[model samples]
Target: MFPPKLATATLFPLTLGLIAHFTIAQATLFIDSEHLPQAKQYDYIVVGAGPGGSVVASRLSQDPNINVLLLEAGPSDEGLLDIQVPYLAFDLEPNTVYDWNYTTTSQPGLGGRNILYPRGRVLGGSTSINLMVWTRSSRDDFDRYAMVSGDDGWSWNAIEPYYRKIEHVVPPVDHHNTTDEIDIGIHGTRGPVNITTANAPYPIDPHVNATSQELGNQYPYNRDMNSGNPLGIGWTQGTYGNGVRSSASSSYIHPFTSRPNLDVLVNATVTRVLRTGHDVETGLPIFSGVEVAQSKTSSVFAINAIKEVILSAGAINTPQLLLLSGIGSSSPLAALGINQTVDLPAVGQRLVDHLVVANQFAMAAPEDDLFEAIRRNETLFNELLVEWERNKQGVMTNGPANHIGWLRVPEDEQGWKEGEDPSSGPTSPHYEFLFAPGFASTVAGTPVPPTGYFMTIFTVLVSPSSSGSVTLASSSPFDPPIIDPAFLNTTFDTQVMRAAIRSAARFVSAHAWDGFVTGQAASFADVNLNSDEQVDAWVRSQASTIWHPTGTASMGRCEDKDSVVDPDLRVRGTKGLRVVDASVLPFIPAAHPQAVVYAFAERAADLIKLGRHLC
Candidate 1:
């Protein structure tokens, strides 16, 4: 060990050097709030520079008169290799620079364990960290939302234009230059977010396609799942443009940075909304701006909004923000010595997420192993990384998992004997499947296999009867919120999950994988396949989140008292405040929520511009 004086001498200049690097290189993104005026005002203040907030802020800033302030709690996405590469999302899932890294409040449904939930803390939010799977929910799902929210504007037909407006459709996965099989009219050509096939073909692609056919009539290959109905097997469409990850920041925010009216601040955490006064009799607080700081120890300053303050801080943080600002239940805030401004009881209630149970099989085809080709060999891996860095091509261009299937619970298992016409799609589906060609240990964070190649199958329960909440752990915004996504609380959810696991087992054992899969591994070997009791036990042990959480700050009709927001995404009792993220969704959609969240924000920009409930 070095002497005390020598240690200090060795570290002092290095500390200053690191500080100088950030001060000079990232001066624009890292705003020196301490030096700015106490309360610099803008026309609109967008809290959370995620998918939703970025879209709204970008569109609102299009008008030169409307000054928009976009704030993110993390650093910029620039020069972050993991953010640029689509396949590196798993590396940022937990305890990473990009994720907020929140955990559940001891879930009683999952053996009373706290599970880690990753929400993007970076400039693009979860969009930069997500697998970039681009798909929408069922049309009936949105129409049902329209009915529940007491507004027809949310109907699928009404919202379809916004869906097109936010998407720039490209070619398929296997073919780069041609759009032969792609449905042209269903997608847009000039949207910011690029929507295309997960494009790079894998060694196991043909096997999954062949297996889909071998499964007989149950799982047919779908022409295009994005064309309203999603009840079939297909190659996943990802949010990718060329070979790079098409995140919300790269698509919406960075492209429009030249606009003089927009100001984006990274590493700025929002503490609470600044309320100026209250509505006379209603007691609803009139919003002015948001108070922000770099961290708990930093000095908090206000960024005043001239027209509105939008919270797109995602499902977990959005409700936590409302609670800290005295907009939640009276009992909880009063106990914390916080005065209640708007007594909305549902601020942190009715939280939902897509919980999944995964299974892994030992790949018989050792020659086509991703673990061997990418991770095991250093020289080849470094060369691939170099290729990706130089031209943004190679294996790094695709996500870890690609083959996604939306399927109904089998008729025999669910006690529904009749098969409905899928042309218009079933009203909804209970399960979705994601197939991957990699070691389960590497992708799903499980114990590594002793040797050889492996593949994973995840069965996700899309619609669950049970729900959870995100309550304030303490009054301090520095403390993380209580996220309890009470998974498998209901018998139906538990039963459906068991069926989903069984379906995955059957899919892996099918003739399509006869030469590819040698044997099943992990929990599958430990549990008795024939017994329902054993399967339920296995599900409780292996179930994890797909990271799609919503409905904490839900919108509903006035009669729906549990609703925190109104028909037009406004906080029920407050003026000049609105929620335009996944939290505002009344129920969890039947598909991944990123695409839906983008479309919601696109329409929200128009509604906020009109200053009405409907656009």
Candidate 2:
């Protein structure tokens, strides 16, 4: 259920509008499992409707002759107001029905705490519930992908056009002239997904921008971070326009739902991939179909794909589905009483994610606090909601932060194991800072203070050396996989985080925030930031994932023994099947992955269309 702050009457109309629009105009495009024909087949069967699957499915369906089926394990993203409004993003996760609500294995690094790992169980997947920060990452990140996968097609130069093809820069909700805020020439003006800067100005925005000027080149002002050079403080761009969240579903699927060739089934889970036959030439098992069911006990139905089965169930579920279909390590499958169809030992290995710690401080004045005030005062919150619903303006038009910075630690100063720096290149950011004008806690159920103004600076370790794995808890698809990100497992990762926290402390020390900041608040009040040991301890207790999980089913050279998928994103030792999603990224990008995923999927659609001829 949605929060009580939003009136049901206001939300009912939106729901009714969606229902009427879909059912009357495009009834054939959306199918319920109860009415789904048993022998129905399509040209392509896309497993998940995230950015990867949505792009692939939508692009493929553009050809009227090529029919597409996009399956989502969750409900539709029709009228979920919390998901629609940018400011209410934090309230839609953890234990909500819109989230997967999986918990990680206890980690010794975080005092044996089981972190809450939330994956969106909605139409747009994680993009439907994510914070919506759009970052293209560094140019070197894509070049590194090309290097690892032994394919020049994955290079930054080759993929830059795809980034342009995926973005459609729109006016901010406030309709402020974005003259100096963005670089218009670098962005795509007519793309599917909408991108924008902060809709309204925040009190902390100018201060953060001024700090970049005060700090000189160490913290420089980058007018545009998405220009393939994301290495400085700038306005945070998001996947939104006119105060509405522009998700993969909203951008790629919903607008195209009227297409007669595309059929999307919600609440339909693909239980496992099914091997149909063997290829005549390679003798590799041909996996051209999948078994889907609405529930564990419901009727199981096998759906075949004439062309290919594109797996885009994201990092966690993609690997889990592969293992369930007898395509993982032999020893693990033998223990689970499952047959090993393909002895691919690296199916679920190399899981990577970014760790963020929130550093909070009490604000000097209460009147400047808008977020905390909205959280505490129901009347103000409702008023803001009405303002957003009537006209896309006010704080609800934007997210928690207006500005963000991506910086790298000086190479000579840091401690490196065997002198190997984990970053892709000199331009890649090692850490990031997200400036929030109000109290922000990553931990679930943290209550907002009853009466005080606060600000939080999120210190994120973007370039983590530590890696983890996603393994099967059991053979049953109903059971969730054991997701162990292994956060701060290595000293290198912790060292980077410690540097990020110190950097945040130094950033606020600038004269721009002299009267704005009073002192450290909450957990930081007792701990001394000057002591290295204390800061490390505080990080261990506060660190949590930003929910950008990738690389569980990584891409590599075709002959590479450890790689799960080849350069073409085709599953190794399998024919007529490919894995597209965050799972196929060989290395996690040094920024938010939604924009990267969108670009990767755009390129993947071309590869799928051109087949092996894509150079």
Candidate 3:
């Protein structure tokens, strides 16, 4: 096994280059069963090589005695150039090779239209295709999660160290070594994930400043969101080293690829968990590992987990796996003709995803339209690609929305105080406004603006009240689940979204945008902004997902009837089975969940190592 990561977070440019350069070379970390011994048992079997599973496998394999077998449903994250570039996340999202390409079941709230829901299908999972924004939920949310899970280990204080342990903060290029917008002590010197500022933060940071000024300090600005208070305008921090995307496969797995005990298998699609026996005491079904198949028609192979079978297949697939394995609610299992081993009715309930809406504003400076130059003109893009390949610098290395603003739903407009900001202070932002410069009109059916220079403010609901579910579409494990995150199902959620859109509209109208913004897009202008009802209607027609889904296989206190997993991440009625992904998050944090998932997996590794869930 490899030694612990060096105690220093400081890395010279040469060290950084070596790490990014050889990321794909570590694909040797994966081994097909064809080359393996006949022995099918391993000390620990981690399902999925996403952020959570990657961390667990790497850490558990640290002890040479512990053999870790990580199974990935997709191909290895080798030679995927889009997965390496920070900005290319947009390009990767629509591709089936990198994303699961799941869609919601026609939402009644969203004008009964089915929205495309992308999940990572490759080795690094969603991290390989995600926009790479890095930040955790509010501190209050973690504390609340602890309360719901009945475990102090789920508390912010309990998980903060893990956050620090897994983080290695890198400053933006030319910004020096100083923490630009990050708070002191709130970051780490050494951990697997690389957090750094984009080389170019979209050229519209001045607009962020002007918008904040127009707000008259009523909302003020947040200096650093990662430090517990995320309410304010700040430069977005991406999970990157210079410009190369720092995926879990790259950060956690690649760093320890030489570890003999850690074996990863790619292109192994798991069908379900296996139950070979039952616990003698509680009579809970004992997990015997999992069944894998090369394809839907391939012969099944059962791999035994000598110790435990941990599901890190993310929120969507984890619950599906449990239900398919006869470890879920009796009613659903009966319908599918699958015998129920566990009556956990809450396995696929309470699903949540961030509902986002975008407003397009016309930018007068046609010459300043960045997308036209890079997106349409292959010559310009090629030049930028050359710069990125050479030094990992330039606009090609920039994540889409670099200047982000976290705001609470302020209670004010036209001498009116709505008093509707429900979240706890600035530390817990309720809304997110992502500034995308030269990002007007839809290009290729995405939210991108038309083929010209236009600025856009994508308003997002960070803490939504509405919830949905992931249910079986059929009895077959190969069939996709019915995802119904019933976006804006509740009236309160609708009100919050209305407030968010209006607030974004106000920011666009700020005098600061006067010189650049000529007018609102005709699509937005067609709406009746004068009436609150029309604004709500407009939002209902246009809202889409921000791609953060959680809370399906939620962790909860014993009293919670809908809870599927306990605070220990073990299913309610099973032994030797645990979930270690976003599925276990009792509630979606105020920020993105990628960081939270990494941190929780660290705590999970410690808990498992210490035998916290011993039978």
Query: Residue 20 deviation, candidate 2, in Å?
Result: 7.3
lDDT of candidate 3 over 5-88, digit per residue (tens): 112222245345655765747557554667555664589999999988998999999999988898999877765666786765
**What CA RMSD would you report for each candidate?**
5.7, 2.4, 6.3
- Give the higher-TM-score candidate: 2 or 3: 2
Rank list by TM-score: 2, 1, 3
Clashing pairs in 2: none
Backbone clashes for every candidate come to 1, 0, 11
Give the winner by TM-score.
2
Summarize candidate 1's per-residue lDDT along 1-615 as a digit string, tens digits: 000010122324434545565456554454666644345568899999898999999999999989888989988876566677676665666777788988887777777767778899999999999888887788878888888888888888988888889899866434564343346688888999988876677777778788778885877787667777777788888898677788899999988877768888888999998788777877767886898989889888777787889999999999999999999899989998878888899998999999877677778777676744565566666666667666767777787666888888765677422442111236567888888776553123455555767777778888777899898878899999988999888777877888888878887777888878877765566777789899888777777788899999998986677898888888887878999899999888888899999989998899888878541
List residue ranges in candidate 2 displaced over 4 A.
1-31, 37-40, 613-615
What is the per-residue lDDT of model 2 for residues 1-615, given as tens digits with 9 covering 90 to 100? 111232333455655665676566445445576665556669999999999999999999999999899999988887677789898886787778889899999978887888889898989999999989999999999999999988988988999999889889998977888877899899898999999999988878878988999996679999999888889899999999879999999999989988878889988999999999998988999999999998888889888999999999999999999999999999999899999999899999999999988888888898666666766676787788778878978888897689999999866648767666688997799999998878877665666666668888999989888899999999899999999999988888888888888888888889998999887887776668778799999988888888989999999887787999999899998988899999999899999999888888998888888877321
Worst 10 residues of 3 by lDDT: 1-10
How does model 3 score by TM-score? 0.91
lDDT of each: 0.79, 0.86, 0.77
* Candidate 2 Cα deviation (angstroms), residue 597: 1.0
Candidate 1 regions off by >4 Å? 1-30, 34-40, 172-181, 279-283, 415-427, 441-445
Query: lDDT winner among the candidates?
Result: 2
